[model samples]
Target: MRVIDKFKMFSIGPLVPSAFSDGNDPKDKSFGCELFDKSEKNYHQWLDSRPEGSVVYVSFGSLAVLKKEQEIEILRGLLESERPFLWTRRKGEDEGKKKNLEYDDVIIDEKLGLIVPWCSQMEVLCHKSIGCFVTHCGWNSTMESLVSGVPIVGYPQFSDQTTNAKMLEEVWGIGVRAKEVEGIVKREELKRCLGILMENGEKGEEIKRNVKKWRILALGAVKIGGSSHDNLKKFIEGL
Candidate 1:
């Protein structure tokens, strides 16, 4: 198993370019070398139609398998928010559950939201339409949101996710963590967390400011002549 420290070093910090560091350029094509094309045409169409800084992108990463109640809470919260959203429910998830209870009906209603089995997450985050991210606080997902300059509503499930969410909300001030009650993040808590990040109040403005600061720093770390690029270059030379 990969040690978490080593993973963090290569994936974040100042030693390596983040996974989505160069994502702003859709025509770059360099990422295609390592990432597969998982996005659908309709997803792109939906993203294009959304106004800039308007849509809420939600995904809990690939490994999280939410309970039916948890899923319902999230869906209900999203619906209550009344914001345009794109949510990804990966394959084989929520299996054996009733069709009506699975939230599939809401996903099929395009006017409300859109859902897909899998998507190019980097591409989605890079899109101008994305304003906020509802995430699982996985390391890569956290880094992607940071570099993309999108604020977050963190719903961490386990392990390092809790730590990442703490940093996102408390340390970084770029997001808010949903408060769980009896091991469940209720719909009201979810909506409250979303509002704290998405609204244009004092706290929300501060979070956006921090997000912009981090985004510039993230991009600079990977650009030519930046700290990360120099470190990488020196390592290669020593080899």
Candidate 2:
């Protein structure tokens, strides 16, 4: 079994360049992640409490932990920047235990921030006023950010997030990752990355342009005769 694990079972080069490829692997079915239309709920009233052209959205991906210290540091950084923010604090039931830890609440003062246990992520991203994201770089979050055409401040926690960060910053020209990793994030680096992502700087302009191109490609991929649509047809036929 160990020796078998070391062998190459298939090729993946042809699949890399195409937005959709004819691959029979089970993973192929999930390639086109859907983006939903706006929700009916009136969460915008809450989100609009912050000023237009401001407000950052901060959230680690589902199942990721926000260490208590890391949470505090993130709060401090956001406060210091003086930008209005809508943050999502993890509140779901613990997977391994039913008990819950008390989350810090002192930082939610109205001068700068609003902290919700959980926010409607897709809806918030699609909102016109949201300026940037402080994200964990999960594929779902990454896809949402791309689809929304927003730049990100990547705070990759684990798994493929680090790789996704590389693509966003280096390859796709979309976002920047925080300098702080593990442990606690610092105020200065947080402010710096936020500035680059939100300001009228060259870096920000470049990312905005690139992300627009990506949005166009994403649409093309989903339309009829596009790679993603064709892949869907082939997938159903295989069944």
Candidate 3:
């Protein structure tokens, strides 16, 4: 709600990229360094090989780190869910600060999962194979997942993330928040949340439907002649 003041305020935007847009591009906006682009495996091809809505995508973003125990729980949970997953653990982490935990060294069955240092996040989220995201609940990631119509398993670390998780789960009804004990989200709990999202259950289906609804709504708002597009045009005309 905008307050009535001397300066007018008009709501405009949620300009999601082409995955959820009627834009000309067949892809969402992508900008990344060539190093990540030239990774050994074609991550995009990997995504293409999987069944639609079958992959679990996990990333803690670049800055967040888990306790060694937490990392173990997360890894086990993903395996326990028995869903194919793609996980990214940013390379060159500060090992000292991370308490000597090395995520890259962990072995995963190639058939079950793949771990990479970096990839195009927006592109990954937009891919049809992504059924769910295990994320830190950062705002950008949250929006990308919603636009892609993928559900979430929020493992928020700090700041606005906690609140963002609440909105994603409680307000939007699009996902579930992992319960933690002594600052650690246990393996069983993580697996339980994953099941709630990926299993053929009432809650899972509801969340999927809600996220799909948001995707359509977001796409509708940004298309030509839509509310957001018209708002921008009107603003420009007034200038």
Candidate 4:
């Protein structure tokens, strides 16, 4: 079936598969493994240290890689937002060269922003302080953010991300598309998008309200008689 068809099935008043998290099974705990509390002391410390509603989480999922220039542009945009942010920049494959080290060598303000190789995304979303998510619109990450009740600033770059962005911005009303970055987003466009996302605008408030509605739908989908829950039960019984 087509992705759209599947999405329709899933949304037909709760009888479709429950694609709840970044996991094969809805209940899988280790699908996208997170740090233990003891091991993530630094992350936890940073979270605790920030003022409430002061940070944005920026991530592009696991498979996507940013060019050095792309990474720098993204950093510049985040810095321009003037709001604290948490960004994840994984080690690049071609980082043996010194040019790549520029990405590695750059220092971010510990108080305003934190960059890491990976992070407990679910945990981060659930935090009260996170006001917005600048995401690449991967379905798993999208679901995680909605479930956690946070709104998104969609910066779609590929494949399903475009579709997910549409769902968030159009259907679910939980996000805003950075249309200023038409075709592809650049640093300046990102800055504008982030500004609107962080600001208290009429559109942003609408997105927030719509996101809450979607959150209820998501939860209902996993409840006993919900579509996702029923589908899972049927599949298991068949197995």
The candidate maximizing TM-score is 3
| TM of each candidate vs. truth | 0.83, 0.75, 0.84, 0.76
Q: Kindly state the number of residue pairs that clash in model 4.
A: 2
Candidate maximizing lDDT: 3
Which runs of model 2 end up more than 4 angstroms from their true locations?
1-42, 49-51, 91-107
What is candidate 2's lDDT per residue for 92-198, written digit by digit as tens? 33311212223455425444565555556766776667889999999888986786677899988889999999899999998898887545668788999989877
What clash pairs does model 3 have?
A: none
Clashes of 3: 0
lDDT by residue (tens digit), candidate 3, 145-233: 88677899999999889999999999999999999999999989988998898888999999988998987776777888878888778
Rank the models by TM-score, top first: 3, 1, 4, 2
Question: How do the residues 1-239 of candidate 1 rate in per-residue lDDT, one tens digit apiece?
Answer: 56955444433243223443453454432234323335443677889998898788999987888887888888899889888888877744343122322345654356667766567777788788998999999998898788778999998999999999999899988899888888889999988877877778899899999999988888788877767777677666656
- How would you encode candidate 4's per-residue C-alpha lDDT over 1-239 as one tens digit per residue? 89956654433322223344222334332234443221222666777777776788888887777566667777877877777887765554333222223445565656667776677777677676788898989888898888777889887778999999998888888887766333456778777666655678887677778777887777677666777767766666656
- Which residue ranges in model 3 land beyond 4 Å of their true spot? 1-7, 18-20, 23-38, 91-106, 234-239
Q: After superposition, how far is residue 83 of candidate 3 from its true place, in Å?
A: 1.3
- Ranked candidates, highest lDDT first: 3, 1, 4, 2
Go through the candidates in order and give the C-alpha RMSD of each one to the true structure. Answer: 5.1, 8.3, 4.3, 6.2
Question: Which window of ten consecutive residues has the lowest lDDT sum in model 1?
Answer: 93-102
In model 1, which runs have C-alpha deviations exceeding 4 angstroms? 1-30, 33-41, 91-108
- Evaluate candidate 4 by giving its C-alpha RMSD to the native, one decimal: 6.2
State in Å the error of residue 179, model 1: 0.7
